[model samples]
Target: MPSDARSTDGSDPLDLSGGERFGVWRAARARRRREREEVRRFTAVSRRRRITWIASVGGVLTLAVACIAAAYTPVMAVREIHVEGARLVSSDLIVRDLDGELGTPLPLVDRSAIKAALVKYPLIQSYSVESRPPSTLVVRIVERRPVGVITDGDAFDLVDVAGVVLTSSPRRPDGYPLITFEGGSGSSGFAAAAAVVRSLPTEVLATVDEVTASTVDDVTLTLADSGAVVAWGSSEDSAAKAVALQTLMAAYPPDAVARYDVSSPESVVVDPR
Candidate 1:
């Protein structure tokens, strides 16, 4: 019988022989094995990538933690404090006040504490604090300058331009003129007097012994040794009045003049003895 002939029992006409069927089965099995091997390779590659990513993330987190820890340690602690822009107030006093912040970590230093410590000093008008990395803290201060002295009962109170009492003593300090106002430092008269005193030239200021103001418009200054009185009208045209007074004083010597009226400034009058 032909090898390709149909069976008489109605079996499949093209049915494979045993060897051919075995070969087909082997081919399918090989294909399935190859597919399984490819799946395993892909899974292994994916797992390796995941492990590397996790390791990289863990390394970064560990490095960040170490850096933060170092910042809070003695390695970044404040070792020195520097003070600047202090004139009347001693730098040593400011440094002593900041001693509490010493040895604290640079990143952990409390700025509010520093400010609180500094506020106790009335001389410090304004201040700034700077943190220099790894070891140093810097403090810069602006001090209030005393412009005049006020007589408080028997004691003399040194005051700044804003009328803040800087210091008080039983005896009056030299170089600062005595200032008196009708309503005290908070009055408009004192405000006007303070402004006039601040505007005077150094030469004129040196000769002033006392300043008095009853109202904002009526301000007067008395010369130190000469006792010459200056009638300065209001705070207006103060600079011009200062110049006029200087010229008038130069023209008529201090001993020769009793009074100077520079209220108008443009037209100055001098009363001579």
Candidate 2:
């Protein structure tokens, strides 16, 4: 068919195509439309990926800043201190001494400072510290126990097994026996006396009055009421010796005997006063 020439409504004939030319033009237009659609699809995907990346990086940075601020803020700092397990050392004193930790972040409190402050207190044997998040601190204390007292003139110095003096008084305090040794505290006599005194049974210990040691081999205990001297020998075999003394005392009352010798533990003897 020839290119149609026609007039509709008295207009000029419309230009129209058929055959190869028309097919070529139609294919070109479709290709152009597909290319534009591809470009639009690619642009939308790239834009979405960029937005997601920006949001992820911004979120991570925000979290990092928040963590740093919380770590240093006063809201997480120490405001109060509590002391536990304290007996000889006052709990209030411990809390007051640790006041330097106040206003410090809970995670940043100095352990060395705490130890330094507690070192000045002689009664504290050991201690531990804890943080109760947001605003509280806790300190636990262990105190030394007095084993006996050593007398110098009119003063009585209470001492532990290690010979560290805990306190001193002018008058004798009850429930503690007197410790008398030839050498102050450096000698084997003092060590032996301490070991022997600590080894005595509870019942036998209450009846005892004084612990005396001239040498490691000559430790003695004088009964408080009867003045009966117990020859307690060395610290060795002390448990056995204590048992023997109790058995002998049962057989022969301490008040009736002047001295009870149980240094050998297995063999015992008593002399009448």
Cα lDDT, all candidates: 0.92, 0.87
lDDT of 1: 0.92
- Candidate 1 on 73-183: residue-level lDDT in tens? 998999999999988888998899889988999888999999998998888899998888878999999999888999999999999999998888999999999999988
Q: How big is the positional error of residue 259 in model 1, measured in Å on the Cα after superposition?
A: 1.5
lDDT of 1 at 265: 90
In order of listing, the candidates' clash counts read 0, 0
For candidate 2, write residues 1-273 as lDDT tens digits: 796455656555444456767888989999999999999999999999999999999999999999778867999899899999888778988888889999999889999999999998877788899988768898888898777888878999888788878888998878888999987876787789889888888888888889999989999999999999999888999989988998998899988999999998878888998
Query: Could you give the C-alpha RMSD of every candidate to the true structure, in order shown?
Result: 8.0, 11.5
